[model samples]
Target chain A: MRAAARPGGKVTIAEVAARAGVSKGSVSLAMNDKPGVSAATREKVLKAARELGWLPNQAARSLSSAATQVSNIGLVIARPARMLGLEPFYMEFVSGIESVLVERSYSLLLRLVHDVDEEIGVLDGWGRSKQISGSIMVDFTVDDPRVAPIAALGLPVIAVGHPDLTGGLPSVWTDDGAAVTEAVRYLAALGHRRLARVGGPATLGHSMIRSEAFAKAVADLNLEPGRILPTDFSGEQGARATRALLASAQRPTAILYDNDIMAVAGLSVATEMGVSVPAELSLLAWDDSQLCRLTHPPLSAMSHDVFAFGAEVTRRLMDLIDHGDAEVGAVPTPVLVPRGTTARAH
Target chain B: MRAAARPGGKVTIAEVAARAGVSKGSVSLAMNDKPGVSAATREKVLKAARELGWLPNQAARSLSSAATQVSNIGLVIARPARMLGLEPFYMEFVSGIESVLVERSYSLLLRLVHDVDEEIGVLDGWGRSKQISGSIMVDFTVDDPRVAPIAALGLPVIAVGHPDLTGGLPSVWTDDGAAVTEAVRYLAALGHRRLARVGGPATLGHSMIRSEAFAKAVADLNLEPGRILPTDFSGEQGARATRALLASAQRPTAILYDNDIMAVAGLSVATEMGVSVPAELSLLAWDDSQLCRLTHPPLSAMSHDVFAFGAEVTRRLMDLIDHGDAEVGAVPTPVLVPRGTTARAH
Candidate 1:
């Protein structure tokens, strides 16, 4: 056995093993409470470790071959923190991610960045520092700059966006285009010709996809050209878009929103403007949170289980980390749930 | 100089220093970009580190005397993840905490546990592993079991609850008691004799504080005995409590909710039951989230800036970490923000 060498007077595991009259490997198994160690040996190791005042330094353990013992998964969200707080999608998604992570005794290292560039920097730092085992990337845009650099880092990652936008990265995504088409078809079936969509920033990959799908759906139904107004996904902006659509020369009979908060805001705006819901205007919301049910004329929504989506994404990432690769797939498309906010157009 | 020793074939700073023909301290200074190293020395160290493919391991650095280099702050929320996502207060508070942390280039290590016992375990692990420099504890209940164990861990923590509940930990809290009293007085001034309060779980420290204050305020104002119902802070429970209150033998002329979600839920229940808000029933909400403004007859609220409050708690934690102590103080109390949902009872 090696003699105790207290570097900077801090107790080392080797010293504990030396004191316990066991090999370093036995000490590790005993400390971690893994199998292959007898109860007597484990007790002796624990007593020696206690007497030596040795706390298992996870940092040192990470440096050795036991890197798998470090259980931290990174999630970098590229959005304004203020806006992120109000959006139910992320919170629910994180909760879903947490549900899966807790089962494995892994922790999620969450960071909110201003943009993709900042997110890349954060991810790169985490990768080099070995602070995270894997990462989940969100909010992909057209020709996302993060794809190339992040891929080069060779860190296990799961991108949460369209396959085209993710640049061949392993990804789990929702078919927003299909969901949008379904929503338009449902509204058209209800005898709506003049349709409008209040979308998120046009630069967002999913938003652009939804916009294109909306236009195609309108054309296919032989309806007038659909109006698409983009916003920053804020309630105030959603209210403004609703007002503009209502006050237009040829006011649309139906409006679709990118999220429930904006949909709720549009509902309030309709009430304030004395425009009756489902009578003068039919409103459809995306990402049906509890907010949809809490509204007066509970909103119709293109609803998908976001919590399940989050769980699926996490499961894929975990698979990638454990088995070195995971299959790329699409989650369930959002389906139209016709609530009080939609009715036959007059 | 000592020859290169690759125990696990991982390049160390000592190897880099030997290759650079400089001291290990100079190599560290150059790598961290700290002052005291000359420009030429810095360049030499960088070149050697690059040639050796040496990436500074943060975990190893944390184990060394430079433990301050690790910049993680722990935040554990002891609530069900499902409920946490729907509550805007926590997300906004986290965002606020992040805002302050970003300025200092620190990161928040967030976790959601089942209860206080789980939270204590998580905190203890974090403390022992040196994964976090400090932590922020929230959701204190009566006779919080966490105080003594957590205090014993000797990790710097800022408790977000009343002093009595925090059990001598440095704390930052809002005056919920004073706010409840003021809310009762405001309703009484509006000629509301029959008032009702839908509170959070009675076991919660703040909830108990508010309950006692409500009773005292009712007695002091010579008003009718008020009805207080407690829920799990869910919108569904809020709706159920509202229905129960409205169905009572002496229906309240005014109702106050513990959160904006519950208040919004209560509003929907009132509308469903054919009760005219402010005409036959008045509603007041706590924690003025955007949901309060989105509702029809925008909810009147006991409003306080939760975002700012979160920022303040982080600042205090930072101070405690830097200065070894922080002052216990109450933030601005929630003030009445009367909007369309409140009026003089007939």
Candidate 2:
């Protein structure tokens, strides 16, 4: 009855029943979704299978497959899950993806990897055998190696990043350059001459765009472009950067962070160092997560409609995967959410 | 070379190639993960699938099966993915489980569900089929019906909840009664005359214990317990409860929340209503997620190490599933984390 060699042999239904604390009949009832078993009991049977580390038998798989199928979509986060959490943009964006995916009875295969190489490997493995029908790619760096890897293989994929990085992949992106210009212009309008930015890793295309835009804004304002402190999007790094920035001789009254978590960390660091927010220093954040709103004085943020962006990207990916001819991609706009963190220069 | 009747056969790869502005060989390279196609061309192939409503045949399933060889554990979150994002407990707990599962070459089949009923189907149907070995169950209630379903089917399951709800199955639980008692005693010791608790949903067994314990403490201390406001653990519910309490003339100086998210909502409500924390009012949070530490001045909490709890639960489940002769359950204890939110009652 067994098709192939597994490291472990098949576990009997009796063992599954024993582990679930139910009878074999209960297991059979749950497996069949018959009226005999209660909802709670069915869950227990399922839980027992999980605990036993059981896989589906051929018969069970065939039975379940006939009714409902699990749709898989590959997602390579391009960062550790912990770091990804710092940017509320991810959660909202994921929520958006889930909003659509759930409706379509699709499931997400999410992975957190350290580098672009690993990300590409994950994609190659997921796509080649059809573990997923399609996949989404993020965090495009200039001259990204993944672009060539994907292009050469002709894998079915969507790039949620810069078009320049993909060498022609269907891309859905936020206008980071435009958003950075707006953030800088706002700082200038506040009569702040010197401004500093705590940014994400330098390898990210969005970071590069923001960094270049920040430089251009500084030159346009004739204000000290000040310094660009690149960070790994870690709260600890943001705290240290804020501490060092404060001790500088050319201290800036205004500071902008790449994401909300960093801004929150910066707030804690600034408060510890006896810097008064908005009075002695002004703070800003990008990717306005709920953390921005929860701060003692809320954080002013350069917010994009991230949830909508996710939905749009998902729609595009689905389209690219399902339709032979579809409109390729779109560049989303951004808006600034004003909270308690920013004010006119003191 | 054709297998069973397949859907995608009618639409030849040539049609996809013709519509995608690429050659058939480029399309083949993209589909096969062979070099020669560009990232853009690959995206064209993927986009075509989405547009054409094509589901790759055995591509994803066969591919993933070859790479993982990892044992699977099904996890039904029993909550929407968005809410799951806000709760730090899941992030930490899942990490804890993964920290151990990875070593065993076990992967978690994580799903976010809207209700308990949907979960039953997931387990009985998808979870029953070789998707996972055993599943983890959480938030047990009195007269939990899952016990019977699992018992009947005889599936191997481990519960990260109470024993009774697990239907005498191996379970891991927190000592919520003792934790609640300690919280009330602490408040009473602080000279507070009135106490109130914003607890989780009534259907959850943990909430029942916490509520009962809170009631007993109030009666023993000769303080008015008033009411246990049970909520769905949403931010809006927390805000509404806080407002109602604040409007009351018998406003208690001390308020305890079932979770960090609700506590955060309470903090916001208090702030929005001009109530100074620990000065005009005091707050306490249970479960001790990271949000407590990140909040302004930090939140005082009844803390238990959830990461450890998750790990312990996983281990216990494995024990039951593997050996079937072991101490099936252990209840963890909670200690108070005295941060800035709680102080001597005014």
Q: Pick the candidate with the highest TM-score.
A: 1
lDDT of 1 at A190: 92
Provide fnat values for all models in the order shown. 0.26, 0.04
Candidate 2 residues B1-346, lDDT tens each? 1111113334666777777778878877776555788877887875664344343344444544444432557677666656655665666676566555644645456666666655665665544444556777876779775554454344567767766566565566777888899999998898887888998888888899889889988898899764689987866677688889988888978899988777877887788889999897889988786567667767899997777777777776676557653455455579998898898987
Q: What 10-residue stretch in candidate 2 chain B is worst by lDDT?
A: B1-10
Off by over 4 Å in 2: A1-69, A84-87, A114-117, A151-155, A324-327, B1-71, B101-107, B151-155, B314-327
What value does the lDDT take at residue A1 in candidate 1?
Answer: 11
How far in Å is the alpha carbon of A142 misplaced in model 1? Answer: 1.0
Per-residue lDDT of candidate 1, residues B1-346 (tens digit): 1111122237888999999999999998876656999978977886676555464764554344332355779998877768877888887898888778777767788777766655665775666566778999999988787776566556789899998898767788999999999999999999999999999999999999999999999999999999999999989999999999999899999999999999999999999999999899999999998888899999999998888898899998998888777766899999999999999999
Query: What lDDT does each candidate get?
Result: 0.83, 0.72
State the DockQ of every prediction: 0.18, 0.10
Best by lDDT: 1
Chain B TM (all candidates): 0.83, 0.77
